[model samples]
Target: MTAISRTGAGRRGVATLICGALAAGGLAAAGAAALAPGAAYASSHREAPLISGTPQYDNTDVYAFVSPDKPDSTTIIANWIPFEEPAGGPNFFQFAEDAQYDLHIDNNGDAKDDLIFRYTFNTHTKNKKTFLYNTGVVESLDDPDLNITQTYDLELIKLKNKRVEHETKLADDVPVAPSNVGKASMPYYSKLRDQAIYKLPNDAKTFAGQADDPFFLDLRVFDLLYGGDLSEVGNDTLKGYNVNSIALQVPTDLIAESKHQPIVGIWSTTQRRNAQGYYEQVSRLGNPLVNEVVNPIKDKDKFNASEPKDDAQFLKNVTNPELPKLIEAIYKIKAPAEPRNDLVDVFLKGVKGLNQPPYVTPSEELRLNTSIKPSMHPKRLGVLDGDNAGFPNGRRLTDDVIDASLQVVEGELVGSKNDLGDAVDKNDKSFEKYFPYVALPTEGSRGKTAKSSADTKSALGDGLTGATSENTPLIAASAGAGAAGILLIGGGLMWWRRMRRNY
Candidate 1:
């Protein structure tokens, strides 16, 4: 979100050389001039028209990074069902039972998935007689009062030459962390979330549940970059929203080809069962905003359905991106030259020598170098600011993707150097520091009452003290119930405290 003076055409002269280097298979140096588009963050909340209508099956975002706590492992997180209102009730957000949420890894960088982790969910309602999500104050995931619940199956499918080479069920009937209904219903939401973190073989961990939408940006770009006058910038549009998230952590050696070739490409897809009972790939995401910002309206949905191997069909969109031209028209800034091979390196192929595979098949997937250790102090700007441990290597929860994307699109690579951003620098809430790094979902009771336990307890205490001796027993009982409700909400405080310690 910062601005800087342009260095002029002195830098622009290198574009041709970059293209030449790419053609001559010497792009390692040329591609190093700028950060990859993988760091250019775009929130795909209802990005395409068709996918917009089906939020449950829509892929919102995908994040990959080396596990900070356990540096030997890699973590991949994917989200769905964006912009969920905390108060939206009766039928709270849930994963699509008929959909297969999959995370794909192209270890050999052939633009084909070598490994796929597929998650399928099943919804359960304990009481058909009640309209409530919980029949009573829910104490635990398996509590009978937690009427509506869900469990999921995790399958690890290995592939070769686009054919299923082998498939193994990694987890069966794992409890999904339920939605945070309210303080009264889910006082121990964090405990429930911890219970949902199921351990997999080989020191891997998996979690599926509602979470604070980790994406933070001013989505007002649809309104001509904030009413076309830059008046509407700086707002975190997704402030209070939530999303259903799935997170997986595994050993780096498991997905990488070898320590000699440690890079891996990652992406996610949603396959929904159609009318004919066939599962169709409806949504796909790798880099933050490829489909949302790069592809045009006509190709957005198609990009979602297309595979990385077939990415040549959409090369023109990247070479002649429309965003720069829009900036040129609106703000009188110059667009980068066409046939942007630099963009190809940023978007399709990984940045040379950084995260790119040796024989990468020019595709759109988040290519991560697993050998890069986690940063001791991460910079929000990621690789642009020399934090190789962050985005462009692989996105972390704290990476400032929107700002990076804006600067890159405005010609940071082709020498039109300037700091362009939406002014939204960070998420509304701090991300968790441990595995399954997303923040907890906003409760349905959020903003309805005092969040602090001390406040709630004091208010209930005052009520009890004001009661007459004749009615003291009744008031004390009511106060006891109120205090119990306060304890339930206090559990959230305990979770935050724990997070702070781990963080």
Candidate 2:
């Protein structure tokens, strides 16, 4: 199901909060366990019921931001196949050829997609008779030894003025970068990844391949979400993880309808032609985690399948968020109250002047203001730290969403008064400083689960400090808003903000 049209509803309301950057959603909340692998605490892993069982097409996370280095273009990256173990050989992870993965832009913002960027992958096995992914050291994406390879085609379709126009071959037969097997197999991994970057006819640049997963969070946050000792919990759980990413870098005006109002809302979704011969949205994400922690189980699947227009049913959940209440109940932390128009305006609508499109609807989509110039000293904490070009504006590769999410949801403002964080401060690897900005995928041979942090025992003194939950008083602060990292809201959506969380 694609191509729905709507006129303009309007842009977000004025700065009713501290800053106009935060949208909504985080990597995953620190609490609430789920019945499925990706269902835990509302990160974009296996966010929905049906897609949790199918990781290949489960939309993990979508990041949209104006290129920090190249501010003239907008970078949109959509990831899939999460919690990837680098060494899963024989058959390494690949995009599902049968599924259609898409990144949509709601330029006019009536909760309908005005511009759509779709990617369909084709996995080709050169020597199907072979058991190995590559018979020998894979020289290139086109190397004959590569027994199995994948390539994709990209299309930019649009619904404008009630007219549907299709651009069939924005990029065609584009070779996807191969999995980083090992140094022996992929000696020049950088070259191999760069080779896959295809410049589109629309003057956009595209790259589809395996890359390091940029998301960072303390996974144990689900279990009271503590990790003072690195050994027990502070380790980066996604250290060796990899993902199939479809990325595009295009001029702001190419996607957004207006030149003056460069604000545009974006989201990514995956769908497959089902048994009934109907295309069904299996995974949908904009801001982040709205499904995992925000919605009741009964409505989670429905939420995934439905459109942003239907978000009103779930509006109550955000207006009166249950996660903050749950956190306050268990952790005895004080959070903001309901009718959280603050959250509604930031999460559903864009923060007024920053990312909120001139004409928009209350929908779940990553909104970016192309006008916000990139920051050289980019803060991983994003808007909270006052880097307007960071996440919640439109997530950059280095944005520390976990911390930002925790601070905002806890009712803290973007100030130094309260320090709420998961302790896993950044990504496993430093992201590349250029286009296709995510770091290369972890080598298959080197992949493994994260271990405890090295500083674990030293700081906490063998669980003594870690056990001071009751002794440490929650810091108290006003609900005055602060700057935010841009993210949005949805089942798989991730909206970002900076805040104080006092105990």
Candidate 3:
């Protein structure tokens, strides 16, 4: 919701790179550039037009890494849809039965996944009788002995040559239980989620489940862009929140060679009933939902529809899209001095190698090469300074990726010739050490006649009391102009392009 605007030219440049090839004539290229359009940052939680309506199968984000808790193993997590209220349920969220939930790994960087873990869910509703809520006071049952029960099953499918190489049923050895509905159901949701965890053929660990959501961002700030104050919106808004989560843990050895060269790229997808009974898909490939939406690209729909398993074909589409030329045509500025074959290298190969002078890494892809082991964890990895918990490693909740992305475009971390912007700290909040990491509170509990254990826990985690305030400015003064210009230009170009396409 942050209304950062890119100028017409800047947006045109972005649009050209993303839309499609430049026309044969120089004028045509210019015409395409002029048609560049605006692109918006699709919110990982509630951005997609289709998925937002269907939370059960909508995948909000996907994360993969070697477990910090157990460095020897890898963990893959996919969050289905977003904004799930823990207590909001006559029927709580569950995975789709017809959908395929998968975890992909690319040991060989052809931009394709070498290993895959697919899962499906089945729910059995019994007794045919239904009640919305259980008030602890049980009414007379027509059939006292008849009770409702539900359960599901999971599977791990390995693929080679686009065909199933092997299929392993996780439920074969483990019992798959349905989520806990209430007392009658025993709330065994956690246990059912745990059943999905299994050991791979090589003793590698794997898991999938619905855990609380772990992403934090301020949508209110975006709403304020039309005309509102973001300064008053503290980081507390995202505190004590939760979302549905799917997690997996595996061994790095199972994913990459000991040599540790970069060997993985990840993506998540959601398929729903299309106009035809066939499924329509929505995907987040390589670094969550950024590239397909925020970063420049022409085939936004195609990007969303494609799967990570088909990366070889799509990688080429991402690297050499006709959009760039279209942007150049619109902007009237010369493109990067040299032919950017490195676009493929940086966008597809990975960012580690792209950190050189003159050239800067294009979009941030969370790259995890099994080989590089830092002696210490970085404070902030992606965009948050001192935030080592972001992309190219593993993304964390507190990472202010918008700021990080601006920094990347400006080439701040790698020191490109391009003029970069200063950093911004929109939300000056700190986090708690719990399942969902979020900022602590700044006030003390009031109007409380008596404090219970739950109150005390909430107080401690709320950060309202005994919490220090940090006055970190979200954006440096110097960065405002260039960043705004880039946003406006880029956005304008995207808008133009879309209009042209429609015609």
TM-score per candidate, chains pooled: 0.81, 0.78, 0.57
Best by TM-score: 1
How far is 502's C-alpha from truth in model 3 (Å)?
Answer: 54
For model 3, residues 91-151, the per-residue Cα lDDT tens digits are 6555676666666655554444456666555644433333332222112221121132223
Worst 10 residues of 3 by lDDT: 31-40
Model 2 over residues 1-503: C-alpha lDDT tens digits?
11111121221222312111121111133222111112111346765677788898877777888887778889999898988888888778999877889888877767777888889988887655446676555667787656688888888887765467666558778999988887656667788898998887657799999999887765654443332112344467778889889899998888877787788877888888888887778778776545766677777777777777666766565666566665555455555655555454455566676777656667666778887888878777676566777766777778877656565555543221334555566787888888899998888764332222222223223223223443223211111121122221332232222222221
On residues 33-107, what C-alpha lDDT tens digit does candidate 1 reach at each position?
222322222246887899899999988889999999999999999999989998899899999999999999999
Rank by TM-score, descending? 1, 2, 3
Give stretches of model 3 more than 4 Å off: 1-43, 132-152, 172-208, 224-229, 233-241, 257-262, 272-280, 289-300, 308-348, 353-365, 374-378, 382-390, 396-400, 413-503
Model 1 Cα RMSD, 1 decimal: 12.8
**Candidate with more favorable, higher TM-score: 1 or 3:** 1
Pairs in steric clash, model 1: none
Q: Pick the candidate with the highest lDDT.
A: 1
